[model samples]
Target: MSALAPAVPRRTPLDSFAGTWHLTRFMLRRDRVRLTVWTVSLLALYAYFVTALSALYPAAEDRQGRAALMEQPASIFLGGPNYGLDDYTIGAMFANEMTLWMIGLLGVMNMFEVVRNTRAEEESGRAEMVRSGAVGRHAAVAASLLTVVFANVVFALLGSALLITAGGLAVADTFALSTAIAVTGLVFAAVALVTSQLTTHGRGATGLGLAVLGFAVLVRGIGDLQAEPGEHGTWLSWLSPIAWAQQMRAYVDLRWWPLALSVVAILVLLALGAFLASKRDFDGALLTGGSGRAEAPSMLSNPLAMSWRQQRIALFWWFLGTFVMFGATGTYLGEGVEDMVDDIAGSNPEAAKMFGDDPLTGFLAIMILYAALAAAGYAIATTLRAKNEEADGRLDITLAKPVSRGRWFAAHLAVVAFGAFVLTMISGALALWAGALVNGEVELATFLKGGAAFLPAVAVFMALTAALYAWVPKITPVVWALFAFTAITGMFGPLFDLPDAVAGISPIWWVGRYPQEPIEPSHMIGLSVVAAVLLVAAFVGFRRRDITS
Candidate 1:
């Protein structure tokens, strides 16, 4: 019988996804708190925007005036194409003004979630351990993708429900916008999956994913700017998934066709990611790094220098990102400042009171606050790097050398401090430069002072993160929760008519909205003192504790 043909195994198409559902459940359990926080924060943001808009523009004329203000080049560049501007309703305004921003935020969340589960797991060696069990070759990637998809769906459903109930928005329109947001998030998750296959490290995968996101934003912005006022963007916008979400045009002649583009892109990317995964070996990457030098660099001789070397790439990306975003925003300050301020002041007295008299200064103060928030984010991430090192057993190895625990911890803190200050200053300088190019009246010194004024507040957050990492390493993530609380309070307290005692809880609030309101010395000194105390606590705690890893 032809030597009894060797029994050949029959492979089903779904064989590669054998343990996908099991792994997906495991991921859900692992990321329960993280997913909950993300979902809640996004929903709260949507609610805040809707509430603020309702209060800011009670009449059709107010909404129309806001739309006219948004017609300027800078607004269009930052916002969406000028859809529904002719007779802009509140729903239409939400669709045009908020959709792109929400999409961008969701895209970041999805990309990080995907990379954290897939590439980060592999880098930490846990993925190999899991695969050695009953898991199939593509089970981990499938599980990550599934988990992210579930999160997006939950966000879409809850967000749509909130809009319909809270804002009394049309059911159809709310669903359309929420669906766009969810689908856009899926596209980025797929992009991250493909990127994870390309790079061996989690950070590399995340950077590649963010680079694609940035490119999409740029293309969409250019396309929108190239279009005539009060019209849809040119075909270039059609190439971007972001633009696809925006072009759904919820509440403004809603079109469902654009979402088809997003769905197709997601499918293509997911397939490519799977094919690449099949081609690569476990714990391997399609894009390999170059060989290392024979000798160590001089910069590796000291702990501080080594910390700087590890963090420089992230710092560069932060600077570049802030430069482009703030510069674009600065360009809008020139001619549109007066009309924009007037619209806010005329419709919403609370907003007017917050902005103060000088429109330019008031606007710059708000922008600087945003810049400070970004700097604080950088600080928190840098601070957490120290904890990651300890958890990965690197700290134990380094400590075995002549390096002291306090010194090693302090080295990371120094990098965080330097990076925060540099990022704040760069943001302030670029905004002034870009505004001057258009307005010609922006005072560089005033903007710089505005940036500097927030440094103490930024330091407070960095120090808080360090303290958390030192004492309660397991709860270090609470710093992000604290950040979210502060962000909501500081950004929306005035609009919400929150009590002074409650608003004062945010460190940023104590700074008194610089340039709009004069910076108080007492507040700055208090914040500095708090930061110093926290740093001392971090050093003491870190020195006393045993290295866990």
Candidate 2:
């Protein structure tokens, strides 16, 4: 052992995170716009929610009445376990009604942010290049988590300040609620990290993360429905990080223990993710994908077929999710529509307006609106797949073949249009069928017409996304911003007392509330014409633009 083996230093655990700060800085720089948008949106939504709640229920009696309505299974499923309902204050209402939704939104945002930086970077070969530098094996994951945590911290601080100053909520309760929201988001970010280690594809990771979220929602909803007011939900609720956030009881009791659960979970998940990441080869996953066919099927011969093949799995997930959610809502509605309507109307007239005089039809119309929004989301995602393919250089390879750019682009749009229509129809039919199963009477045709009424709006959104993709691929994400604006306006416009001119800017607002009011043929014809123009513009722009890659 010649002087030889002067022992080389063994790597310590901290060595794995050696370049974490550098990568974190890089990630922040890369996602500055995205992170800023999420932050600002959350803050604005929180402000709006606080302001709306204060204005809508100015008195203690009003708050208590609103709390009574929240006892409904549908309300509990959408909101949270009925905490502080007996003495419901504005702060308590915010904690009970809005906490879960905010955390859920944050969960989605965190999932995408983590998956984008981790698995997506790996898929794009960027991680490999980064790791070739002085970066440690775990630096990328650490960086992603740090960046997300940083964003959450900023949100929590700003949110706490906003609640205190704007809503005049209790300082302690506001801090507790804001902290819980931030930690809950971190929990999901950790979940996404684990998922990213489980699959090679970014879509697979994102899907897995979302599936976990869906499960959490389902479990938490069911658990909350099983429990009475002022009580902790069933054990199933305890299993969800979302429930953990709510269990903090920010306004009622303000317990800090629930947050400990989330912290422990984050640690465990982060550890597991790191272990998996280290054990696998770069660009590999612990759960390796199975081998595919040695030969391409005849279906792969066309651009349209290829597009369907790429999108069918995601479409299936969407359909399944929509079915489960609406089916559950319908089943709950079966309890007593009249009573439910009376409770809702008695509590909040603004919300009651969404359901017209014919309560059942009006309720179904609102569901149809939700279904249409879901379809629009699916359409946007499907349309953006073209942009993704182009950015990844796959579209160039496909175009290098005999296929024309216009044909290839058109195939994606066709899939988007058809998929959106089917999703909307499925949501309406399933909701009606499920409701009829329990309630004993629902006309399928009425719901179908309600679904059909939104087809034009769906088409417009799809066309708009396609046009953006064709003309300015860099700004394709603006479509999502538009989608968000439309959703907020459609859902809260009535409550906010927004003017018709303001609300009319949303394409969904253009569609008549079906079953409640007859869908106007003129609205349909005009929307179709607008969609046609946008599609024409998209086709023309695609023909002229350079392939991004």
Candidate 3:
């Protein structure tokens, strides 16, 4: 009896990682469609860019000229740092044209994926149910990270293979380039994991991660824009994970040390997230930011008003980014519009045509298109809120009251449509004012015309999203797919040599290139008609469909 002493529990490295593999499989099963679609689509897009570039710039001089133009300030701001721009190969052009944008896109995808699997599940109460079993505290986070890493690896292998074999890129350059892209995505994935631990709401977690991304892009742009040609040091690009990918200089020097910096950052973030997860309760957030208002306001009594209240924060961020980032673009172009326009025209004939006579107005036109896309994104997210609410069993309570399906749905659609209109105007006005201030002239008419040009396109997307929400609620995510298809085709169609028939499917294509070309009143009228039809159909469908929880 005396010899029977206290026993210590034995733990191994695997103990901390217990259930990670099973959880990973479960997450994969849950998100298979999403994961597969994202991976294949991204890889195909990357491959298309590489393949198209080789055909577009078959001549060596053509490649060199395009590469030099990429070194311009506007290019660096629009596309991240263009490494190896002097190299006479498609790989270098691909690095310049696609790397930064791809990094940003992949960062966003990683953020949403990590947050959806971790914080979103926890918020929805599914995570607690899973954790109640034999799952370890760290398993969910670990599984999410590992799954993302695996996806990135798959993307790198497929993307690099395409570049090497199809595009005839040097093996070393392709390897380095692909690794840089993968590592950039991993950094954001880790950031999302840390954010998921800190924020109670999944949207907050996403916003925190994207805010970091925005800050990094801004720092890298400012740093590179100011640094002298072939200059280094004292620039914030050295500190941005996105910039670190370009600093690797895939085709030129194949510098790999910057990746070590990313590795260090990722490890530190993962460790911090694990520690925080262990310290907090199962469903608790480390940063709750206190409670909301004790009672609902009178304004919130209306479904339309409530929708606005729910979406105001997201709209605020979009408006801020559009105002600052797009406005900064205008400011940069204003310093020497003629030179910038000529440089851009020399590189891209389609852009030259789109910009037309007044370079400022032309630039504003391009910004308007981007702003319209952002507005569409806001609308899509807002429309999808119905799905979220329904899944959370909140929609039933509202429906059980006096709320008619049509009225409730119409209220959401109205809010989304109205918000997009306001945000687009705000973005356009700010960009116009900034550009005017720099050029020593202000033209309110130009701002109004340019900003209003894309509203029809934005409305079409909003209406499309509403239709999806009404008729095919289960496949509402496909609206994003449609949006992506249009965005990719519209943005890269010329470069990729895609047929007009294929590119014409996007509503963006219908928004005739403005300022350079006259606005098409007939086309705008048609878009408006289409939007109205979609909304009417959506309302009818919503009334007849079963509202599921």
RMSD of each: 2.1, 2.6, 3.3
Model 2 RMSD vs true structure: 2.6
Clashes of each: 0, 0, 0
Total backbone collisions, model 2 = 0
Clashing pairs in 1: none
Which residue pairs in model 2 clash with each other? none
Which residue pairs overlap in candidate 3's backbone? none
**Candidate 3 Cα errors over 4 Å, as ranges:** 1-9, 60-72, 78-81, 85-89, 233-235, 291-293, 331-335, 343-367, 428-433, 436-444, 492-504
Return the TM-score for each candidate structure: 0.95, 0.92, 0.89
What are the per-residue Cα lDDT tens digits for candidate 1 across 452-478?
Answer: 888999999999999988888999988
Q: State model 3's lDDT.
A: 0.78
RMSD in angstroms, candidate 1?
2.1
Error of 3 at 362 (Å): 6.5
Q: Of the pair 1 and 3, which is ahead by TM-score?
A: 1
Put down candidate 2 lDDT per residue, 1-549, tens digits, no spaces.
Answer: 557657788999898778999999999998999999999999999998898788767777667767766776667886767678889999989988788778878988999999999999999999999988988888899899999999999999999999998899999889999999899989989999999999999999999998998888888988888886557888888988899889888888888899999999999999898888879888998889679889899879799999888888888888887877677666544435666565656666665665556655666667777888999999998898888888899999998999998888888888878789878888655565575467666667777877888889899999999999889888888888889888877766666668888777788888967777888899899999999999999999999989966
Model 1, position 222, has a per-residue lDDT of 90
Better of 2 and 3 by TM-score: 2
